[model samples]
Target: MRRTFLTSMALSMGLAAGVAQAQEKSLTLCWAAWDPANALTELSRDFTARTGIAMNFEFVPWTSFADRFLNELNSRGKLCDLMIGDSQWLGLAAENGHYVKLNDFFEKEGIDINDFLPATVYNYSTWPKGSPNYWALPAMGDALAWVYRKDWFARPELREAFRKEYGRELAPPRTWDELMEVAKFFTGREIDGKVRYGVAIYTERGSEGITMGVTSALYPWGFRYQDPEQPYRMEGFVNSPEAVEALEAYKALYECCTPPGHSDAYMVANLDAYKSGQVAMQMNWFAFFPGILKDEQVGEVSGFFVNPRQNEEASVLGGQGISVVSYSDKKDLALQYIKWFAQPEVQQKWWALGGYSAHRAVLEAPDFPESAPFAGDFLEAMSNVRDFWQEPEYAELLQAMQRRIHDYVVADKGTAKEALDKLIQDWTEIFEDAGKL
Candidate 1:
């Protein structure tokens, strides 16, 4: 009788262990370390509370973020069960099967991709640009937007001076020419009894910072990476006279209007300059706007604008999408996390938590545009967001642009035409090597 009782106890223990193992599923998500990522970590507590699955995160700084995460993806590392990768990485991640296709899961879960903002759905989630080959979910909808000191713009004397000099109201600029004029007007000037520069445009020498910043102006000025119809015929398009002029304008803004040492500024530095009252205007991602609104020094005086236009309005698209790593043993759990994240309530909380949700439901909420100082500009900017290359060789293409543009813009090593001409040559060679030309 004692032997039989011991056998029953051991069987019950083994079954309980199996059930515990099944219910204890967990996942690790990796993303760039920023304010949004911190917010996400806080918001993810809800997911844990509801599902009982554990969540782990790896937050890497923006500078070496791509290098660290890409290496993990390339090696099929199980370290990251999920990743919030840049939109431009979609092409390579999908082509190499580093990401699990989310189409079937979306359909099965009844998560309508249409619920996301159209631009974000196209740029962040789709792999082939316009196709429905979904490999990720639009997590953050971002665009390059402007922040300026409204108190200065509203000053009667400054307004009169600006109107006298430029023959227009000193409101947020509507064109790149006006933007430059605004920048020029404020540089080295005393405002509120403190000297400040005109703007802090991205001129970082490393990585894709310069390209991302310049393209905000370039797209409206008629720069094209390649022939839209032929895709790889980039020679005349990338090096067009209009593109050269745009590059020249970008360099001019950086050299004459920005503060000293801004040649190395990127997102964080630009934000710091604005927060510290060192610049009258700064260009940054919409993701940073909430923090700016919370700032004590600049918040009360801050103003926001969509990217200024030349021939047409355009802003650089800046955001990432959440993806399930293809090699993840916890893919099902990761997918559950994404599904939970895609819900409307979660998206609303995402916004409340400092993440810029791409969900149309949240964005289209009647009060959304007026919810924050920059919300309207965010909506307007998304309407005309332009993206860089989404090719499998995008990193290589981006690196080449970084080198070419930084050398010309920051180092003043070449003319705008020379810089763009060299860029065209570099892109052509890249395509040729990839057998696309």
Candidate 2:
């Protein structure tokens, strides 16, 4: 009787241990709470089904996303097994050991970083800029692009009026000067019994909104962060005559074309303005393109285009890389997830589910251009993208630019040249402090 009772106890203990092990097979992926997050949640179900591992998510709003996740990473908290961190965070995360370096794991699993888009791999994974030291995988590919009201542009009266005024067909502008002309023509115009503004640009003062928006103009007007040969030297390149002109042009657009009371507008605000027929065009990231195309009110009328060219073609890069949190206990499980996600078929499905896939196999496929109305434009924008500072001091550098540019462009505090000059001073001090100078 004693032997039989001991046998039953041992069997019960084994069952309990099995249940605990099964529960431990789960992973939590953290990212911003947006349309792409919802798509990722759906796509992860396939990962769970294939590996018998449950997926968990802790998504935060965009406004608080960086602060929340950075705090978690800084504290070495085990909140997330995987993190889809912003591209700008790569330098800090890698240097601070917040993310696991996956070079060996990638090699063992036969995952080629080369299979991803070169721009994404360069921006999203490498810590030392163009080095091979990868700490993440490019999960979402994005760039700043324009979406205009095609239905409005196609109107005969408007077309003839625009042609007469600008000496060109009322089509998407291929140059910044032409874009300005188009904006001037559309501003204060009545469309469908409503007064419509020319554009909804990124003028939000509080965060990275305005910087991203203004950089689109700055890049085409030949702005560079530093002398390519001598890094951290910002005087000539950052505040050049061309860059000042670009800044002035951006300010002009904001003052003359944007909707009334749009002094502080960002992605959601711009989207709202465009959807309500308050604006003729909106500048936004391609990540939101899928949702915009599916929007009930403005979906059918919207047409996409790459950023207009000036002295050069360029667009602001926007996206995140997926990284394994070094603090997590489930490192092996997180690696498995990355391995599974790198598969071409899975990446194609990721795109289908509304998440931008950075894999070349998905992007370069013959059917890719026809996959969505905005796909071709997305490809074009990604090809000539530029990113802000990705050093460990990225936040400091970004904040400095934000203050200087916003004071000038929105508050009307200084001249374009003065703003850029002050920006150079701020950046020089930062780099000097970090001993990069």
Candidate 3:
């Protein structure tokens, strides 16, 4: 969902040294500049102090992270020694031989692989399963979940009104239909004398914001980006009859319920609106939840819930684990740092620093602060999360799907079927060209 993962054997980087490398090898790393990245950077500083390996981070803007990493890695440029790429980049990086295997390192450090959530570790670690090697340990686990203004929803009059209107009591929604109903319920509702919208969704096109935001909704309606018969191939699900039905439902939900200029919404936009008390419920990634506690204005009353789906099985695929580049000169040091970070104490530190933990035990830790408010809900949802594109051409395939979703949600250029059909054609062509069809 955000910038980008694994593999086997004792693969060693080319090395010739009679040289006393500086007390610490200065390794350059790149990752997104969001709160989680900040949290990890703090951990990296601790790493620097101990090993004198001197890790330096380059915080790239999400806007151009892909192009920037590509320009560097493709040219064998030295700008980045270790990079945290978007999830979609995993297959490409692995295929391109840009990552080092980590299984040996884990064993050498005496770190138990089972300590991590298999869902988070397996996909990000290995290129193809059954390989004894791995690429990256999942640096963080992420999923889509919603948080709401409990105070407003709990008001006696509002609950009665919702009960009358929907034939049920007001509680966090359990289905897409209920999501719409609740979003509509609070869209123009006044609370504490301020007008508020019901929900905030990301629609921006700069990167993959639109897709990242919509995939959670898309999966629940029996929407599949591709036919299962083929690998690395996508169908025109975005514009399919079912997908269209979902999109129509989405259009109605957003049109009737979101704040002004919401058509331009992105993660930060939604966060800003929710923080400002301009929306009653907002869906976002977990990393931003801690900020609510510090923002003060809307911090005191927000409650959390898992996103609802039409099917009882929740429909969402979250972001993935991070990896070290195989091409880096500092593989040994990078492995060392990841080992330190994998321990329970370090992961707990990551959570306290507002970093989303891909380590399940740390997230589910019983003593997790209630002060942060939404921590319990997030840990619970993390257990059931999924990730998309278990194929090699994952990035290009994802881009194609986003293009079709954009057409349905933004351009209004054609029916969801028409747009999705085109995407399927486009994706099929790519697969055919790659001999994956």
Candidate 1 lDDT score relative to the true structure: 0.90
> Lowest lDDT 10-mer window, candidate 2?
61-70
Better of 1 and 2 by lDDT: 2
Q: Evaluated with TM-score, which candidate comes out highest?
A: 2
Q: 1-437 in candidate 3: lDDT tens per residue? A: 12210111112211223123543477787887787787788877877788778778888776677778866767766667677775556667777777666777778888776777776666666667436466777777777888888888889999999999989999888888998999998888888799889999877776777776776676677777656675444544445677767767776676789898888677788888888889988888877777766667877788887778685445344555666676677777777777778888888788778887777677556676463677766666666665666556766776776777777777677765676678778778777887877
On lDDT, the stronger of 2 and 3 is 2
Model 3 global lDDT (CA atoms, 0 to 1): 0.73
lDDT of 1 by residue, 1-437 (tens): 99999999999999999878855677799999988998999999999899988888999988888889989988989899989999999999999999999999999999999999989999998978889899999998899989999898899999999899989899898899998999999998897688889999998767678989999889999788888899788877888888888889999999889988887889999998888888889999888888887889887888899999998878999999999999999888999999999999999999989999999999999999888878888899999999999998998999999999999988989798888888888888988898988
**Model 2's TM-score against the true structure:** 0.96
| TM-score, per-candidate, Cα-based | 0.94, 0.96, 0.87
Candidates 1 and 3, the one with greater lDDT:
1
* Residue 290, candidate 2: alpha-carbon lDDT: 91
lDDT of 3 at 214: 72
lDDT tens per residue, model 2, 192-262: 78888898999877778899999999999989999999988888999999999999999999999999989
